[model samples]
Each structure stands twice: as structure tokens, then as C-alpha cells.
Target: MAETVAARLLARLREWGVEQVFGYPGDGINGIVAAFEEADDEPRFIQSRHEEMAAFEAVGYAKFSGRPGVCVATSGPGAIHLLNGLYDAKLDHVPVVAIVGQTARAAMGGHYQQEVDLQALFKDVASEYLAEVNVPEQLPNAVDRAFRTALARRAPTALIIPADVQELDYSAPEHVFRQVPSGPPDAPSSVVVPAEDQLARAAAVVNAGSRVAILIGQGARGAADEVMQVAETTGAGVAKALLGKDVLSDDLPYVTGSIGLLGTRASYELMRDCDTLLIVGSSFPYTQFLPDFGQARAVQIDLDGRMAGMRYPTEVNLVGDAGATLRALIPLLRPVTDRSWRGRVEESVADWWSTVERQAMVDASPVNPMRIVHELSLRIPDDAIVTADSGSSTNWYARLLRMRGGMRGSLSGTLATMGAGVPYAIGAKFACPDRPVVALVGDGAMQMNGLAELMTVTRYQDRWTDRRLVVCVFHNNDLNQVTWELRALGGAPKFEESQTLPDIDYAAAARGFGVDGVNVSSPDELGDAWDHALTADGPVLLDVRCDPEVPPIPPHATFEQVKETTEALLKGDPNAWRILVQGVKAKAQEFVPGRR
Candidate 1:
């Protein structure tokens, strides 16, 4: 039998080092499915419960491996379902390639079943590259371009392969048959070196400032050592964006944990007072946390010049790789002898940790989510890959978890979507089979999509490279974040029944899916549950009964937010006053040093 275009395309993917493609099988993709069957196990196709999970899994794989993740789906809704996860990759700036099946070429113009313009559907999300393989000969180059564009741009790229084209026999061009090699060509090396003038100006700004601060993002992942060198040389304290959590160790004296809603007081103060802000590879959206233009002169380093001054007015914009730019500037930096600035911030971070520790130790009736995360932080392997859902669980993960070297994770960076935690953990396991993978998800988010992924986990639990996967469910019986947001933002009572959830026996559900499960009610139970999950040979789900009334208070609360809290208290939400009081206490710590 002659080779099909689908076979040729799959071969290209394998040649490009793709280990797996997360997707579902459908009539639209029968040819591609056949190709998978024929290839045996070259690039394993993971069957996902939902198309969104497939995309999210791909995102998780890419985040852990730093390689473009691949996902495939049938045309129309299957391809449409990928938008949320694709947007996760787009917003987070991770690389992903999506292969979408289409109707036959003849049927595309006709109103055939499941026929929609795949390119048009993906145009906005896959801005980097979107192509339709119309002719049989276009398969090879389109596949190559899709991967290359996805990698170089660090964005999602889509290739729409029509059913007719996929089924067509593959034929090499006469010239290509004679000249082309059997293996794929090596990817071109791309090193973006900043202009000397730009680097010099950036160095000058840092040297001139009496108080310098560095904001590192995901782009600076590979430049951690260089970032530290620069931070120490300039006596600058480093604050990390959420996605950049693993770039530096939280144990570093000058390092501040995640910045923004879940930010530390030390970090907020550092940004408030710093004279020079050195932003490396992060386009942090919350400009309120950054020093104002008049407050500090900004120097930013990013490969994309467009994002240079997008967040803040820049004195120097260096378009280069974060590690490369920092490496170049290190030699020119003059070390600051007076360490008072960073020393002060370091002290603040230490005190803040003390406050956090106290909060974590609170033995309440309903388990404190903080306590669960704290224990997990203490017990998790140094190299574990942790994924948190986009709600209260993220706040806990951000505030409590300390990322060490070799440990990495991700959330819905920009989209801030829920339901990615379980898929991300599963994908992370596939990417780094030896590393322990954990998903921290709230009951709300787990109900949204995580529960379905448990079925995905059970089916492929032992088949993955690493069999150690744990899902920690914060079974609070409420959409806790939304409940708090109503009080904190709108001065409203938990307005509707929509903000709450039915109590789910997640542990029982896990057992139903053929995985190990446990329910933890108290602090002691929580600790023991962690021990069990950490040591379990297969996938385990820890259904932690967390406090629904506890609020995810921000580091700094505004007067308007205070008013809302007061209103909620008046409306008889029992937790409102306690949350308000806690916010007051945290903010008060900013003024009086060494006072809890």
C-alpha cells in the first residue's frame, strides 16, 4: 500500500522529536487515526476525555519540556474546543501546535457535515501561523513551518488537514526525492543579542539608581544564575511573576515570592520604593504593583520589542534573550557596597513568612487550605511538577509553595481559566516521567473539568513515564473566590446560589475511576493524607475538606475593598469581619517593623 499524506505528516512530527499528541479520535480524523495505528508507537496519541483537556495537556507538556506541545482534533467543534487551552498557551507564551481535521477539499465549499473554516476559527488564537494543507505536496513543508513557527514565536500554530488530502497517497517531488535527506533538518539556532548601546544604557540606569529592583518572568527561566548574579551585583531584590515562579529559589535572601493579587508585602513595598525597575522578560499585566513612571526609571529586556514599554515607560529597552542580556550586562555592573536596600526587603520577606507560617498553623474546624499547601510544600519532592487551578487553590499555591531548582509548574497565566490543573498534571507526567506531579484544584474547578480528567488518569495511569500523580482537591463546597470577590469588590452578599457547589465526595469518585483516594477532614488527617499520597505507587486524589469561609485576602487592600467587606459583614456573612480584620493586620505590618 502506498503511504498516505497523514502518514507522511505523522512521520514529520516524529522526526521533530514529538513524543506524544493529546487528542480524540473522530470521523473527521479517521485518516490521521489510521496513520497512528500504522506507526505503532512512534509518537503516542493520548486519548483525552474532552478536546479542551487535550489542548490543556499539550500546554502542560510544553510548559514542562520547553518543547512545542502537539494536539489534534476533528474539524469544527473539536477544533473550536481547543480555544481555551490554546489561549492558555498564547497568553502564557508557551509553544503548541494544533492539527485540526477538515472536510474533504470538494466538500469544504459545500455545506458538508462538520465543515467549518478551521483557519478562520483559529485566526485570532493562532496568530503566529495558521495554514490549510490544500494539495498533497503541501503536507511536508506545512508541518515543518507549523512546528518552527510555534517554537520560534512561542505561540500556538494551527494546520488544517482536510480529510481528502490526508487520505491522498504521498508522493515526493522528483527534485526532493533526489536531494532530500531521510531525516529532518536541524532547527536553526536563534540567539537574539541586544545592541551594545541598549545594553550600555540599561547598565547605566541600574548603576545610577540608589535602589534597584528586578521583576523576572517566564522568559527568564534559563537565566536564573545570571539573574542572581545581577541581583547581587546591583543589590537588587528580585520579584517573580506567577509563571516565573521556578526561575529563582524562594530561599534566596533577596528573592520575593509571586507578585500581584497573591503577592507578598515585601515585594509590593520593594516595587513601591525602588528607584530603578529592571524588568526581565515579563509582561506583568498588573501595572498598579509596578512603580509609577515618575517613581522609577524602567529598563526592560524582552525578545519582542512591542512588549518593551507596554507595561511601563522604559528608559532602556533591550530586545534580547533574558539570560543573554543579563549575562552581557553583568560585566558592566558596579556592585553596590551598601546592602541596606535589599537587606530591608530581605527582612520584610522573613517577617512575612512568619506571618504566613502563623496563618498556616491555625487549627480550625474546617481545614485551612493554607495548612494543606504548607504541608505539601514541606513534603513534596524537590523536583516535583506542581499545577494549580485558577482560583483559591492558586492563591494558596502562590503564597505557600516554595519552588526549588528542578521543580516547575504552570497555571492559566493570562486566561486565568479553571479546569487545567488535572490535565496539566497528567501532561507534566508525560513530559518528565521521573518527576512527581501534583495538581492543586479547588472543588469548583475540579467539578468543572478536573473530575473528567480522573478518568483520563485512570486509563493511562500506569502507561505514563512516571506513575506518581496526585490531585489535591480543596473540597470547600463553594466557589470561594467568587464568593470573596462579591464581598471584596461589590459590597454584596453571596448574591446567588450560583456561587456555591454541591458537596462532592471526590475520594469516592477517584475510587470509581480506579485510582487511590482519601478524604482528609482535620489537620492531622491532612498531614497523614499527604504522606499517603506522596508514597502511593499510582495516582491518588486527596479530597481535603477546606474552609469555605476563609478569604484569599490580597497583600494590600484598598479603602473601597474595605467598604465592601464591611457591607458583607453587615449582610451577615460570618467570615467577612474576620477577613477584613486579617487584611487590616497584614497591611498594618507594613508600617511597624518586627510587629506582627
Candidate 2:
């Protein structure tokens, strides 16, 4: 009896403890697909409607499990379709391994059907690690390298296997197949201890500063205790990047919410006033939100040495694990007893949150989007996993939803792509079946890919015991974010017809797909709808009629932005009047003593 390359590779995946691989099947991958069907191991193949969704599911799985996500696709078009989702993983630095099928090796360069230079196609996205298994003997090594590279680098990797190679008989001895030991795979972990000199220099920078503030990212998620200890010793306020939403409790008095365009007033003030910035495990790209090197002395700590001081210049670049570096530097710093600066900043945070609460409670005609999201934030279980789309929904989720009580979250981080929310919820549910999963998406994004992806939720709805997948669709019938951006920022007068969408009955569609469905057109109906979705026996799609008139105002507005809004309002744009009113109210609050 002889084992095929596909069999051996599948065996290796089992040895590496891969329980499943998300993918779609096609003719080009018939050999590998056949092998997958024959395998009696844990790495079962889960079929998806589209190759893109498969890749997004893989990225979502990695986010939930904190392990390398695996996905497979057929040749040419199948592989090409994966770029968007692969880019999602790449830009966000999530570990994903994409296995793509190729045309037979012998038929290369002869205009063969479904043939492509996969390595070249994936070079930019998977440039960190991309390879093809040209022969049977190379299969094991390619598998090992791809998985290892993805985990170590925290990026997507590609393995292109030609159809002929997948079918080739394994001529190596039986011992060769057993080279990879059968045990749990090595989990992703890092503990980069900086040199003593680097630690001392970083400590000296922190010790010298009177007003310190900390900026955290997803990299510091596991070091929450260390982050707080450093904050306590130095009397610093913490501003989180969107990815670091749960790095610390939202209720913490000194922990400011997210920074950047989606930031709070407290975070903006913290960045504006700090004399020294302590950056930990964050490669936050929006430099304008951070104080310039001239404005503040900085100390940066990152596990990857290359990322140290990449976003902002620093007095000391400590290349080490965030936890380890913070622990080492905490002892050398003196505790700040004068709590005056922190007290003022805390008051600002309180005032800002009160304003947010007022905005969320605003009684409007077409239901305010914030009201739905705020209600969701209050109604969702503590252990819920929320995945938000990239649009108006993201604006509400980022600003309103507070991550606490062991709730987890995932979104298209760096790429900031749409169509990831529903698939992400499905994948998150797959990875952690015991927890509740929710997808927050706008009408535009839901119509883009999420509606079709709901069938995927229907397909796997009964596979797990705890089926708490909820798709909360904001049916506003417009690409509200783009409309506002074009009007307010691009100097356009009104939203073009191209940016608007037809009203969709998403709840009806979900019911058509054999899933539970609810429709709410007003705020009064919201609570019961949420209750129905949360208590449903299977996946539920809640379609809430949302107001497209609400503007996604930033924490701080510039003069130019105000000018544009006034121009749009004078031009009699549909939503500009409400926006102008909101802007005026915000400006008035700014002038009010102790209100900002």
C-alpha cells in the first residue's frame, strides 16, 4: 500500500492539531478534495459558498482561537478570490495559512486551464512567507514552514500545491511520514526581554516625565495587569487603539476609550496634553492622534524590534514583550501623588461619556443608529463575541460598545474592509461554540456580502449546541458613511444616487433562509427584538430600521470641517441640517464650563 502526498500532508496537519479547514471545492482541487473526504482525522473540511468567505472565516477563526487559521481554495479564480480576506489577515497581523490549488506542474507555461503564477499573485499579501510544493517530497516541509511562519510572524502565508503533486504517491519510508510528532501544536507565544541597557534607558525616560500617558494596542491585550500597574505608578491615563478595546476594563477611571477618528474626547485630550508618551505593543498608524516627538518625550516597547519607534520617534526604544518591559520599568519609576492632571482628565472623560449617553438617547423619527447599538451594548451577555462591519455600524460599535466581562471582539482592523461582519460572527461561533456571537452591519455592507453569507449561518446553524449567532442589520437604505464623507469632506453638496441602496427586508430574507427573524422600525420595538434574537434556538437576523440622518461626528472637529458642514447646510442637503445642529450643540457644550 502506498500513501499519496495529499494523505501525508493531511496527516501532518492532524499532527499539528488543526481541527478544521474552511474552504470551497472546485475541479482544480479534485485530488486534494478527494483526499480530504477520505481522511478520517480531525481536520475536517467545511465548505463555504464563496472562496472569499472561506478566507474571512479563517481570519475570524484565528482571531477567536488565537491560533493560525487554515483555509483552502482551488486554482486561478479560487485563489484570486482570497486576496481580499487574505489582505484582512495580513494588514491586521492575524495568523492565517491559505492553501491554494494550482494547475498540474507538467502543464505549466502551455496555456493550461486555470493556471496562474500563485506565488506572484500572493507576493504582496503573503510576502512574509509564500511557497509552492513542486514535488511530493516537498509537501511536508512546505506545510511545516507555512504554518510556522504564519504563527511566528502573525501574518498570512500561502502554500500552492499543484494538482499533480497532490496526487503523487509518497515513495519515502513509513518513518518519513512519522517525522512530525503527534502532539498538540506549539501555541503562539512571545517573551522578548530587552537588554539591560535598553530597559534602563526606557526607565530613565519614564522617570523624568511628570505628565505621562500610555497608548495600548492589541499586542498588549495579555498584559492588562502590567498596563494598569504602570499606569498606577506613574499616574498615567491609558488610550486604547480600536484593536485594544478589551485590553483593560472600560469602567476604569483612568482608561480612556479608543483613539483616532473613532476616539473619545478624553483620549484626544490625553494625547494633546501628555508630556511623555509610553507606547506599549501598539503600531498605531495614525500619528496625528499622538503627540509629535517634539511635543513629548516617548518610550516604546514592542515584541518585534522593527516596530519599536516605527509610528513615533522615541527617546528610548525598548524591544521586548510589553508585559516584561512594563514590569522591568515599573520599579524604577516614582509614584506620582499630585493627582491634579489625572483628576482633570477623569472629569473630561466623565463629561464626554455623559454627552455620548445623551446622543444615544436622542429621540428621532427614523430610529437613531446609536440607540440600537447602545441598547445592544446593554442587552448583550457579558460573554458575547461581537464582530462589526466597516461603515456606520463600526462608528457606533467603536464609540458606544464597552468590552467587559470576558466579551471578545473582531473587526477588519488594518484593511478596514466591508463584508466581514457576518462571516466573522459565523467563524467566531465556530471557534468558540460555547459563547454568544453577534454581527453588527449596516444595510450597505449587509447587502454587499452579509445577506448571502447568512445562508452559511443557516447551513451550520445546527452544528453546535450553543447557537447564539445574531446578525443585527442596520437597514438605513444608504451608504451613510460614504455619503457623509463625500458631502462633508469631499465638498460634495449631497449624496449621489450611486451611494444609496434600496431598502432591504433582511428579517424576511433570514426567515427565507430558515433562520429566526425580527423586524423593528422604531426604538420602542428594539428591546423585544433583541430579546427574541438572544433567546432564539438558532441563528437570528434582527433588521432594525435605522436613521441615516445622524452624522458620525469626531471627538474634535476642525475649522475646515465646520466650514464644509456649513456649506452643505447652506446648500440644503438632506442630512446637513441635522449635522449642523449637532455641530452647534457640540460647540456650545465646548464653551460651557466643565462640560468638555
TM-scores, each model vs. reference: 0.96, 0.95
Model 2 ranges with Cα > 4 A deviation: 173-190, 582-596
Candidate 2 has what TM-score? 0.95
Query: Global CA lDDT of candidate 1, please?
Result: 0.86
C-alpha RMSD values across all candidates: 2.4, 2.5
Best by lDDT: 1
Residue-level lDDT tens digits of model 2 in 1-596: 57888888788888777888899998778888888878863587877778999999999999988878899999999999999999999988899999999998889998899898887899999998998887676677677878888988989999998988888897443356544322235655757788888788888888788889999998998789999999888889999998888678778888888898878888999999999999988888999899865999999888788887789988888887788778877787888898887887788778777777778777665687888878887788888899989997788888888778888886997899989998888789789988889899988888888888888888887776798899999888888788777766866666557777987689999899888889899898998888888877888988999877777888777778767866776776767667666545534544545574
- Highest-scoring model, TM-score: 1
